[model samples]
Target: MKKQAYNPYLPSWEYIPDGEPYVFGDRIYVYGSHDRFRGNAYCLNDYVCWSAPVDDLGDWRYEGVIYPKVSDPLNKDGSMCLYAPDVTVGPDGRYYLYYVLDKVSIISVAVCEEPAGRYEFYGYVHYADGTRLGERKGDEPQFDPGVLTEGDTTYLYTGFCGVGDRSRSGPMVTVLGPDMLTIVEEPIFIAPSEPFSEGSSFIEHEFFEAPSIRKRGDTYYFIYSSIVMHELCYATSKSPTKGFVYGGVVSSNCDMHIHSYKPARKPMYYGSNNHGSIIEIKGQWYIFYHRHTDGTNFSRQGCAELIKFREDGSIIQPEMTSCGLNGGPLAGKGEYPAYLACNLFCKDEEIYTPLEVCGWTAGSLK
Candidate 1:
């Protein structure tokens, strides 16, 4: 086997560094929901997109924002509170972005011909009876916008909350049109896990939101975030467009690693693991998620070791990725300097916060 060099990628935000990432072309595009804790920007989930090109499995070039807050089609008001985003390069050469807006709690999309561009808004999906799909009051379609393609057909899987009369686990599958703008089929119920109370609100959670999908050979696996918004769980089926069964939970149920039930410490506690994405490169699969370092508030960026299936055919749980991973350009790097922690410095600084230098122990720098 060729010992390929490692690319130990870590999480970052445009304004926060905990912004999530996805892959397109030879580069990884990272996007995050903006979080401003004070002033007028507090809790506003605005979004920013960026790209990091990986030439070898060693280093990456950080390209700046491709898209910023322009409009909110769902809210119809243009107030900028964008949430998690999923990017896919369509077979037709256009790039589609599906994201959520916080004020209206609905998922919407915009498309462009280039990987980085000013996207044009497309119409949204609605229920079969013609009621708008996400207009429900409390339970908005939630995290991890997982999309999968089989042949000419594309399917979307998102973690949703089943509010009121809806099924508690939420619908996991909805077919997207070839144009990547609207839904083609009615959304289907797939993952039948237990209900949870998610977010700071901690209301009754529909199951299996924050989903990521991957197809290895003939099997399609749907990895999801679970357990009242803390643990990572997964399900699988042979078909990319069909039956998905619960695959069990990853991470512990307690706050031994961090405190999850309190504010300011929530990200360090137990509330930090949801909204994850997975991608494979050079034969290894990587799980990217968030975690808390102190309390159960906002989550910080986190990743897991590449999961490998045992010879017996069972897959192993992903180990929590840290600054010590033996991959990418920053493998042997030391501590993250204090200056790198300031969100304001990220845009202007020419330095790299190498994966080797990130983690709770690195300490938050400003």
Candidate 2:
């Protein structure tokens, strides 16, 4: 088959957002929340998986619906939905899927024999008495799970920024035993208040949801969408649960363009929240994130860019491009759709065009 590639990475019809990429065996599987095709509510569809071989960036295969919404306990009345999730291979050798039941305010668990296979309900992250953590704890929304396992010890990070519920705080980190279903310790407050700079206050790095944790060498990098709303930031610590210092902004869904959330001298393209993590595939590093379309936040798509770290561990943020996931620029001879663009916005007058974007589709290039 002829290989295909685009900026959104997947086909236009596939509206998978909040992508959490995990490399299992030879394929890099993207486990994320499903959005309706132009529908209203957020994350209105079932969980689907997409994967590609370690050597092939253009060949992506959909892994089918791994878990349906009806399978969730909170969806019994057909109301609640699952949000962004992360998968980690457990000591038992099974893949554990972690996500939150949005309306019910609880973090749930599911397990799959294979990385991209059907996942059955396992249990919920709860206290000793079996009461769910999110429901029993403070009024924070249980959303955007980031999980990791070191040897027999497993860690699950779940939290909400002020975005959903303004009362909510930064992320919470908890230890999961070898069983991968139980919370073994009291969940610890892990981020935001941690100083990111020499004199920066605790409020500087306040959370915005979408937590992603990765281990590079001896440093534990906790990546997430911050209060700025359009970009992803990171913090580094020797331990998974505490003592983290600010890293830097990784990438923006809007390409760091016209967004005014942080007083950009220039602005990012699409004004939407971004979520994704960094992973080393085939010895090369890449930052995975999402983009919005149809001028609405609901219909989002997954996007990625190759990134590299300096000798001192500083990350150089890459510019958003149509060549993402392709490893290089596409053939550049075929006609593509308008929404694939990461930069296409009009100025208040006819003045700003820093990205050199052409027209708004129909006759121009994306």
> lDDT of all predictions, in order shown?
0.50, 0.77
lDDT per residue as tens, model 1, 83-109 = 667767676877777776655545677
- Residue-level lDDT of model 2, residues 1-366, one tens digit each, is 547566788888898888888888898999899988767778988899999887887788988999987777667665777788889999989999988867666778899899988999888887767777776755355678899999888888887766335365468888878888667886887765333323543354567778889999999998988777777888888999889877888887665632333345455464567788998899988888887766567888888888989897878878777767776766768677776666664543122222233344332223
Q: Residue 116 of candidate 2: its Cα lDDT?
A: 85
**CA-only RMSD, every prediction:** 8.7, 4.4
Model 1, residue 91: distance off in Å is: 3.3
Worst 10 residues of 2 by lDDT: 348-357
Report how far off residue 57 is in candidate 1 (Å). Answer: 5.6
Error of 1 at 46 (Å): 3.6
Clashing pairs in 2: 257-267, 257-268, 258-267, 258-268
TM-score of each: 0.69, 0.89
- In terms of TM-score, which candidate is strongest? 2
